[model samples]
Target: MEAKLWFILLCSVVALLLYVIGFWRRKAGEAAFAAARAAATAEDRDRYCRLAVMAGHREACKMFCLARSDFFEDHRPLEPFKSHGIKVVFYGYYYPSRYTDLLNEEQRAFCRSLYQFKEGENHGIGFFKACMSALKLDDAPYHIMFMPCSDEFKYARRFKRLDWYIRTHRKGRTSGLYDVDVFEPRDSLHEAKGGENRILERNYRITGDIKGKQVIIVDDVLTSGQSMADYKEEIERCGGKVVAAIFYGKTVSVPPMLLVKAVVWGGYIKTG
Candidate 1:
């Protein structure tokens, strides 16, 4: 009992410390960013700008974008897996190996920015264009939808930018597509962990119509699959059919399949 109490106290202290640090960092970041804008010397300005970015300032972070062509590799298929009785497609594996760890991290960061920022829309469109070319969704009555985020602004930005790319890019890919907007957020809620249980026990309300449409959920990563399962159940409960789930990658310690595929494609990751 004494040890447990001590552990609890330690955890609380750590959490409080982290919270305080985060608050300080945000303030520092904003100030540094302002200083960078006002600095007369280029060196001092660059230094302050870097500090702001490192401190996680929103505007400062925007000035920097992660894009390295070498990070591009074969992304998709994953042998047509299933999640909660719905077909799933994993475009790539978000793994960092010994040989190409930095590249992998940069690649993951760039990929994540797809849904997080508007600039990523172009990349996201091309990324999906390649995936769409690879997929024979001719027979599937698919409607694009993203993994529902309670943050309405983020969700709205994400789907709006990426969803219509296929439709506008070419005539063939626009056969029977719709922006599946059956659901709307009630209020903001923290996205807690626990995957399925977290989703099942959430406080925010999601109201939707469904209309018996076949949904294709787009997400950044595919992890333990429970979250998708919960999403699948939620979609079903709301009266829509989950035809497929598309992802940028699956998280893994070592991406054996990705390496194998890369080699078979007549090339490997060029570390140069």
Candidate 2:
């Protein structure tokens, strides 16, 4: 039909436009990165940072926004959650390449100061509290669980304690309104396979029973949604209804070459 043909043509044109814009943005980003590297001085680097944004380098813009603690507040997690029977939310984005990995000592110090991690700070609890308040679940009793991370990640260990803190500290004085428990998996996927499917095998076995329980999954980041998808499938299998999921950040893909060069350049600039 003529309508089908028109639809296809429209989609093709839109795809082509997106491709052209992406190519232009990447080229501009590269030029800006090169200029920033050559500039060496703080004032010169700052000037190049503005140029990168003006040139439409999204990554550069992310870095500038991150440094100022203003990450464009336009991330959407709802679309990814539509397929699965779950709701997910994220507070902010963790940059693909941290400034410390791409800048000199002075720059690194400045960047560190911008995003400082104080001792005894648990971002998960903070986000959880905010989520509870926003959802107006002050009087509702619920259970919390964690999507297991690699053993090497500090977040994994921190959650073990944070889980306890939430159950004990976040509880209400009223008996029915404050009951909380944190679930853990005996095993978890350590890594993801490469290529199209990016298939991940479920290595987790829930340590506790959650028959007819309302559960929420807390994670540090949501990458491909594969891990969480697997988590939801397994949790539902155990009769636990997943109401929502919360994450500290969402993962954004970055060019592998840029990441490698950032580390190399950071080391070289530091020594010089």
Which prediction has the highest TM-score against the true structure? 2
The digit string of per-residue lDDT tens for model 1 on 1-272 reads 99999999999999999999999999998899788767776566656766776676645533321111123332234446666676776655553222232232445565455434332354466556555545546755565656655544656555565756656755533312233333445332222333323433332233555658776677666666665677777767777777777776654433333333343233213432
Q: Model 1 — TM-score against the truth?
A: 0.48
Q: Give the per-residue lDDT digits (tens) of candidate 2, residues 1-272.
A: 99999999999999999999989877887798678656767667655665665556655654444433322333543222332556777655444334444444554543232233211244345555655554433455567877654332443454655566676786641111122222333233322333214566444466576778777776665666677778787778888777777765565444343443354345446766
| Runs in model 2 lying further than 4 Å from the true structure | 1-47, 53-83, 98-123, 136-138, 151-156, 172-197, 253-272
Residue-pair clashes per candidate: 1, 0
Reference-based lDDT, residue 53, model 1: 64
RMSD of 1: 14.6
Cα displacement (angstroms), candidate 1, residue 12, comes to: 48
